[model samples]
Target: MTWQLRRAHEADLEAIMHLETITFVHDAWSPTMMARDLGDPACFYLVAFPPDEPSAVEGYAGLLAPRGAVEGDIQTIAVAESARGRGLGRTLMQALINEARKRGARLIFLEVRADNPGAQRLYERLGFIEVGVRRGYYQPDNVDAIVMRLDIPELESMLVETS
Candidate 1:
C-alpha cells in the first residue's frame, strides 16, 4: 500500500509497456511508442514504486496537454495485475492529476473502454463525469469508449478532503 511517485524515465519504458499490454486490449503502445510519448514535451509520465521495491515500478499514469491549454488528457494508467485492488490506480491518478494542476491544467479528460465498469466507477468516484462516447473505438474487440471529463477548478479542495 506504500509507494512513491516520480517522473518516469527511459528506464521505465519496458515496465510501462508491459503494464499497458496487460491492462488494455486495444491501442496498446509498444515500448518504443511509450518511450516516444514519455519523451514528448507535452506529456507527463508518473510512476509508483513500492517502498521496498525501488528498482521496479508497480504502476504508472500518463497525461498529455498542448501548450497553454487549460485541459489535458490522461493517456494511460496501469497497475500490475498482482497489484490491483489496492488503490494503487487511484493513488497514481491523484498524483498525476495534482501534477497536472501544478502545471496549470484546469480540466482532465480520458477515454475508457465502455466495458470497463470497474475503472468507470473509480473515475466517477473521483469526480469525473461521462461526457461522450466514441463508437467502435477499440479495434479487434470493437468496444465503445466512454469519454470522461473532470473539472479541476476546485481540485485543490477535493484533493485536500480526499487526502
Candidate 2:
C-alpha cells in the first residue's frame, strides 16, 4: 500500500484527534488540545494518509525540539485501528525521525506504556533502548511508563538498513 506522509495542517487536527481517540482510548487528546499542539511552533506534526483516500489520516506522529543535551522528544504517535498492522506507524516514525534529523536533532526520546508490547516492539525494532522507567506514570490506571532513547546515528543506520 502506498502511504503519504506530510506536515499536518490546521484542517487535519479534527481527523488527528479522532484517530488519537481510537488509537489511545486510555489517553487521547481532545480537539482543543490537539489544536494547541498544532499551534506550537516548536512541535512538528506529521500525518500519514492513504493514497486513495487523501482526506483520511491513517496515522500521525509528533515531535518537539528540546533544549540543552536533549535533541528532541516524541510527543505522540498513533495509528488508526483500521490502519494498524499495515506498517503505517513505522512509516510515520521514520518520517518523524527524518524530520528531526534535518532539524539538527542528535537524539530522540519517548515514553511508552509498559504494558504496550506492540509499541515496545516497534520502538525496539527501530533501535530505541530502554533508558529508564517512570513508576505510576499514568494516573487513574497507574500504569508505568518505560523511557526509551534512540541515538540519531544508530537510527540513521537502522533507517538505511530498513530502506
Would you list the C-alpha lDDT of every candidate in the order shown? 0.86, 0.85
Q: Using alpha carbons, what is the TM-score of model 2?
A: 0.89
Question: What are the per-residue Cα lDDT tens digits for candidate 2 across 1-163?
Answer: 7788888888898888888887777777778878888888778899888787768888889988743334899999998888888898888888877777877788999999998999999999988999999999966678999999988874445554443
lDDT digits (tens) for residues 4-51 of candidate 1: 888898888877777788777567877777999889989999988987
Report the Cα lDDT for candidate 1.
Answer: 0.86
lDDT for residue 81 in candidate 1, whole number 0-100 = 80
* TM-scores vs. true structure, each candidate: 0.90, 0.89
| Top candidate when judged by TM-score against the true structure | 1
Candidate 1 structure, TM-score to reference: 0.90
